[model samples]
Target: KEFLQWYIKEQGEEEENSEANVKNIKEAGDDLSAVDEKMGTRGG
Candidate 1:
């Protein structure tokens, strides 16, 4: 029973970390796109 409780808590923490990672990745992609746009304008 104690093992099960610990396992559940660990799973919850893992899920939260996974969600945060996904959010960071999306934000990074957006920033990259903005930079790309600026570079494109400069090139032309």
Candidate 2:
């Protein structure tokens, strides 16, 4: 029973971390897209 409790806690932490990572990736992607657009305009 103790092990199960610990496992559940670990899973919850992992899920939170995963969500944070996803949010960071999305923000990074938006920044990259903006940079790409500027580069495209300059190239043309």
After TM-score superposition, what is the CA distance of residue 38 in candidate 2 from its true location, in Å?
Answer: 0.4
The TM-scores, one per candidate, come to 0.66, 0.67
lDDT by residue for model 1 over 1-44, one digit each (tens)?
Answer: 99967765776589987677668778999999999999999997
List RMSD in Å for every model shown: 10.0, 9.6
Q: lDDT of candidate 1? A: 0.83
Error of 2 at 5 (Å): 27
Question: Candidate 2, residues 1-44: lDDT per residue as tens digits?
Answer: 99967766776689987677668779999999999999999998
The Cα RMSD of model 2 versus the native structure comes to 9.6
Candidate 1 is scored at a TM of 0.66
Deviation in Å, model 2, residue 29 alpha carbon:
0.5
